[model samples]
Target: MVAFPDPNHAVRIAANELRIAWRTLRGKSTAQLASVGIVVVFGAAFTAAAAYGAYLGGRGLAENPGELSQLVSLVPAGLATITLFMAAYLTVVQLGDIDVRDGYLTTVPARDVVGGLLLSGYVRAAGLFTAPLLVASAAFAVGAGSPLAFPLAALAVLALTATAFLVGFPIGVGIAYLASRSAIVARFKTLIGAAAFLAYFGLIVSGTFDEAIDPILGVAQASPVSWYADLAVLAVVPSASAAKAGVVLAGSVVLGAGGVLASVRLSERRWYTESVEASERETDSVSSGRLDRLVGRRPAWVARKSWLRARRAPIKLVFVAYPAFLLVTPVQASVEAGHVTSSLPPSIALYGAWMTGAAFTLNPLGDEGAVLPVTAISGISGRDFVGGLVVASAVFGVPLTVAVAGGLAVLSPLPPVALACTVVAAAVLPVLAAALAAGVGTTYPKYDATSISRSREVVVPSMWAFGVYTLAFLLTAGIATAVQVPAAAGALANLLGVADAAVHVGALAVGVLLAGILATVSVRIAVRAFDDYTA
Candidate 1:
């Protein structure tokens, strides 16, 4: 009988594997190196800026010793919040990408496998924040004007940053593991990611409304950054700054210890076979084919396929949500700010057009993936395939445009001319979007599964498509504006009213005709590219 490996032996084996994994990651391609280098440069720049700021802060605090107490009181709270946000975002991205491709560490010992994953999480989180923190400490030291204080300040900042990472790591790993294994959790990931985005967006938006929320903000006066700022202030004042720094250092040690313990416990719990089984079961249920019916017969085939693809592919679903959210929120915000006419309430229709266009242009040929060879072999003309896709886009795209425009008209202060222009512009968007997709799809069809996320493979068409779509939207918007200006300026003037009506009608006709021409061109280009490649 074969004896099972001891837990100690398993851990040793895992550690070895982790060392190898680290080395393997170090041996990346030139492209990967460039990408990492860019990140590091950005990181270093941010750190240098923070360091300068800390120096300035320290100087100001030295001058006004009383401000030291206030700054000291705020740093912990601020640090805690920032740590949470960073950890959550990092966790989501790491977890989302982990199992995207097949053949991930199936042969490794279970203990080592888990250990490697946890270590990777740590590395990712640490890498993201390390530079900024080092810079901040360097800044604090320079500002303090004491070479002796520089090393001490650096040590203090490192301790705090490490503690934050420790706290965030296990939580992130546990959440990511849970999300990857369970379907319910996976669906919720999108919601979680969306919430995170909204929170970030809200932070920026809130600043715009800060005057109204001064009282609430006052309650948060003891934020963590403030405490750190105060610590710097105190360092130059009386010996009281030294005492306060001592307290902060001690707290950092305690927090760091607690975080490590928490992470270990979570990792152990996650490693259990029962937990993995339960997660797998949940995921299986989540990946069910409930929406397959939507992809019905000929005309409906493209729409159905697009819908199904969006549903089954989590990344696609997540991408689609961006346009959806933008249309509903920021677009609405723009309208409210008078950047957009109220007659174009950022609606589902607008999102559909935008998403459909993007999906087509970027992923058109790439989405076909391995099936492209089979498609070519089967003798299906590229023109026919392109036609089907265009048809599919229109099925979903047109109605969404109308609905958004109509909704905007009802809710906001839109003139009839403005409403007409909005509708005309909406109608033009998807066709341009589709045309762009076709052009890109024909030129840079990505075959590799790994190429999905980078999306740089479809660069040429993607750029051209974007330019075309931008121009088309601007032209449509201009036409609409011209029509609206006259109508708005002279609501009772018969000549202006007639001209506005004529322009609106003319714009719509022009848009549709242009769409037809572009669609034909896109189909022709796709067909020719398909033939050349296929032959």
Candidate 2:
């Protein structure tokens, strides 16, 4: 007879979990981590600046001796909120231990298996965020001017990190399971995700960062994150009690351990319970609805069809929203500086338009999923099929592009005529982007399973499609911006014996002309690709 060890053997279970987590992380890390490098690099730079500022902050403390101490006290609260939210949100999006649950339940007790998952979450959470945190803290310490700041900063970070993982792991794990087990949650999750994303975007748009106070004494001086600040003070200033730091450190560990056990128990109870099987069901169809009623202001039918298709899936909209994030920093800067700048308006408009087209128009036929072959064999002409896709994008893309760019331009300090020129460029350029994206995307179509979330698969646009569209849009936006700029177009206007206004208008005319040509050619290419495909 084979002997089996007690399932609740914490050490063994934790070790197994850690090993599996490491293997999982390593296996697909190349592609995922490759994309994460941009964020990592940006974080490193941000941390370096913070560290330099910390040195200055330390100096300020000599003048106001109590300031740093007061500031350190509130760090824990801020950390608490951040850890709670990120851990929970990420948990909902990424975590799903159902498969592991199925595998482990045959031998180990369910509680023990959950214990392992809890351990994995703890390890993964720390590993995921620690590098950036440590980098920033280390930099801050270097600038802090005392030899002791380095060690103190490390302690502070460790304490905060421990607290976060302890709290976040349980919440995240529980939420992940809830999302999996509950049909209502799974159904509404997309909208909730979009809302959460918009909230973050709202924060960036609000420009609340500009009204910053001194870091050592941030606005929240009485929060749990401040406990970490105390640890730092004890590290840098010998007069501070080691006993206090020891107490905080000990509390963090105890809390974490307790959280781990509670989380495992909670997960076992919920995950092992009877659950309903969830899946998608067909909804009422509206494809036959008239275009004018379905999509007002559009006398055309193609865009309306595209909208219906996108609304049904809506997964692609997430990718479409990528360009909007690019606006956050520039918009913040502009708000803080108290005026719209010429560059941001035109650029925002161009990205808006390009993304709109790419979102809907790029994968026209491929996005048809399994039904694509059927569409090809039908009586639909290439002009109607491809034209509808591009027009679908143009319908929303043109107005949105014009609104954002035109609004910004009007708000800018530029003369009225320049603003008018920008508005025109915004209207024309996206059509060009739509055309180019249509052609390029058709040329290099991607129709394969890609992970939208850890547990779900959907077909999104290819990397090549994104790259081609981005490069082309940048070049065209540059032309649009160049004409809008008073300086760049002044010499051209002089050379042609025309006013700057005429030159600007003429530049816009050129963009519109190019758009018309690109659209014609792109539609032709898409038509050819469709005609070549047989049912």
Candidate 3:
């Protein structure tokens, strides 16, 4: 029997695998490139802010050793809790699918294969590690008053992050193994996702209303993450806490190693699954035909077919629901919080309306996937096809926009005139969304298996739609502010209430007209692109 490669060889193999993955991603289309640029820009901005905050935090810790000591004590427990949650989520997502995709691992030497995979997982999680390490380094520099402290702090942070991933990965793989064999586990995945969302929402709400919950602070302090958070603070504090930090860090390493061993054992099982297959079957049986009836027997039917496609795709449904949820829940929460005053601005409500509209527009074309060719071959004019999509956008977009605007009016300080203007803007947003989606689809319509797998089709539409809505909100907010500021200063002396209302109404009308024109032009452009490609 031949001896397997050494540890160093395994690491080399894993590094090469990661390089391949990176190269594959780099070869994506122009749309994908733009999407990546947006993500990078956004991430860089957020990371810079976090690094600055960490520096300040470090300074504060140095000044207040006692507080830092308490915080640092909680780091280990916090790291463990985070690891547990992420591991559980990722494992569930992988269940039923990994065996088929990763079965090649069975043919490789067990230790080498396992080592490579574990290393790959860590590399994939580099983003998670980088942000915290930067913060820890900054914090240590400020707290310790020594440059050396920064590197030490970063090392401590990285170790803690790695420990969490180590613990999480094995548990996740085991769970995936068990989940692959059981229908109950599949249902549980959905439940877990929902629970996670609720838990996050609860945390945000509780933090915001911490003053009201002060009586239960003691009970809340009993949580494991709270303990870990304390450890994190202590890591930055000078003196005795450093020993405690070292102990916690050591514990993390042990736990991580154990988890990796367990995951290796579990990886021996063979399991294969694909969410797309199940999703497609379910969609075809229930939703595909439902829209055919609504749109009639005509092969040229665009609006009905597009709506059906959106409804059938589970991912698309979730994407649409996300914006709608954002629009509705916040307004309801603000009302409950008693934040609404009689003089509330329409800009706030209009912002929500525009967002809801844009969500509908962007996903339609990308969702078409392999069907794009059929539309071309079937003699369906791109103009008429896009017109139908506009109609469907109105169908879905107008109602949601109205509901959001009306909810905001009921909850906030907006007057009837302002509320009406908001509703008008909301109605116009769908048209804007359609125009943006059509433009993007025309420019970059080709998609492959990966696009379907990652749901990248939604990215361009979502991003561009968001950009349009944001610009609209800013413009409207500026106008509203300019008008309201002077009115308030004059104590309603030059309010000219009717004239202000008239101006808003006119603005909304103009926006809608412009959006409609844009939609028409976008469709024309997309049609030309489609023709060029097909020709």
Candidate 4:
């Protein structure tokens, strides 16, 4: 009979994996490292403050055990639900993206690789809480006058977190399993995934997540997971059920072992399964046909190529969603109020133009990927190349922006003059935005692909490019919008301590002057950069 893979071997592999991850973080850019450091520092500080608050609260509630018990009992189920959701989401996004997976599985056991990945995910997710949780546990022991409570509570927390990962990882694997076998899923997965994210984001932004989560919490409380609360409070509370605590301990061990086996089995099935490939051929006829006659050959070819790539893999343009998040509050407020706000039209116009440029022209060189060498050598002039990107973005973005802005303006309370101004701004801003983005993109080109999912990588604009483009676009868009919209012009006048009429006239002149200079300089720079770009 074959012996099962050695548990110690799995433990060793997990330790090494964690070690490598830690080391790899050191190679990140200074800005990236600084950002990570800031996040970690804030997270640790927040948790420490929360632990102190919990200690103080525990001391007060110690005198009245019934009220404290009722509140504390709900903690287990809430925490478990949150942990399970987070772990499962991370696993789903990162399951099969393991580096050199085939080599690892061939050298070691498949179960061991699964074990290592599970441990890695758990540490990445829950490691920050270990110290703070221990401190809180000790504080509870002191408040309740039971020294044994600290160890028991800590142990309970550890077991619950472990079991949550054990169960959650398999659930993620099960999702990957279904996604792998279903062609329909393979075809529309991005749209479905985007819808789910937007729906969840809407709930949060609308402050209705609590309403949605209460039912889930109710189910968790009625399930066996509620045993964790009994185990946690067994030593601290005089009325805590010892029998339930015993059951939780035994159940945790069983679940943990079973979860490992399930993860191994599910991972094997998921990793080995031949994923369903969409058999549909891309129809290039539409993109190539009319566009060629409308524009000359070189520009048309470039525009068609850019449009085709975007249609095939829209995930690369996902960075454009960042602007949408900023607009959600205004849009949500308008939805609730049953009418468009004065602010919504301008906001939509500005961000719509921003999204238009970012969707395509934001990474001219790097976006070409393997074809960069061929594209660089192809007899395409810089003017034709940059003009093509401008044309592609403008073709789609301009009409959409004008339609959205004009449609909203009709529904809004803006004066006819302001409505006309808004439409003009919508039409003009996108073309300039695209030019600015192309220049910024070439200056800070990033060639590496960022992982969007387990099986897909997208070459989005670099952070430096994104930051620079945002600054330029906002400056340009703000000036242009202020000159066009009377309300905005009035606001600028107030901020600058100037007359409204003077601000409006000055803004118009400055806006036009800046737009002309920016458009001219950016287009020239982009053309030069594209012409000089070498693979």
Q: Which candidate is the best by lDDT?
A: 4
lDDT of 3 at 141: 78
- As a whole number from 0 to 100, the lDDT of residue 150 in candidate 4 is 75
Candidates by TM-score, descending order:
4, 2, 1, 3
* Model 2 Cα lDDT, one tens digit per residue, 352-412: 7678668776776667778888777766777667766766777788898899888888888
Model 4 residue 141 distance off true place after TM-score fit, in angstroms: 3.3
* Candidate 4 off by > 4 Å: 1-5, 67-70, 128-131, 142-145, 311-313, 450-458, 482-513
When summed lDDT is taken over every stretch of 10 residues in candidate 4, the lowest stretch is 1-10
lDDT of 4: 0.77
lDDT string for model 4 (81-109, tens) is: 87788777778877423677888888887
Worst 10 residues of 3 by lDDT: 272-281
**TM-score of each model, paired residue for residue:** 0.72, 0.75, 0.67, 0.89
Name the lDDT value of residue 172 in candidate 1: 77
Model 3 alpha-carbon drift over 4 Å, by segment:
1-13, 24-68, 74-103, 109-112, 126-159, 174-250, 265-296, 299-301, 311-337, 340-371, 424-432, 435-500, 523-533
> Looking at model 1, which ten-residue stretch has the lowest summed lDDT?
452-461
What TM-score does candidate 1 get on C-alpha atoms?
0.72
lDDT of 3 by residue, 1-535 (tens): 3233357846965686577658867987665688789978877777766667767766776676654344454444454455555654554453212222244455655555656666765665544545755665675576557576676666666666677676777677767666565656554555665576666555554344354344344343454324334344544554445655566666767776676666666665523333222222333435545655655434225766665565444344444434434333443455566785433334334444444444444444455666766766776665656556656666666676567555656666555655666655555665565554565555544344334332133333544444554464445333333233224424333455446556555555665565556556666776666555452
* Angstrom error at residue 131, model 4: 4.9
- Candidate lDDT values, in order: 0.54, 0.67, 0.54, 0.77
Q: Give me the runs in candidate 2 sitting further than 4 Å from their true place.
A: 1-33, 36-82, 96-110, 129-159, 173-191, 210-225, 229-236, 261-288, 292-309, 337-344, 369-371, 407-416, 485-497
Q: Is candidate 2 or candidate 4 better by lDDT?
A: 4
Question: Alpha-carbon error at 284 in model 1, in Å?
Answer: 19
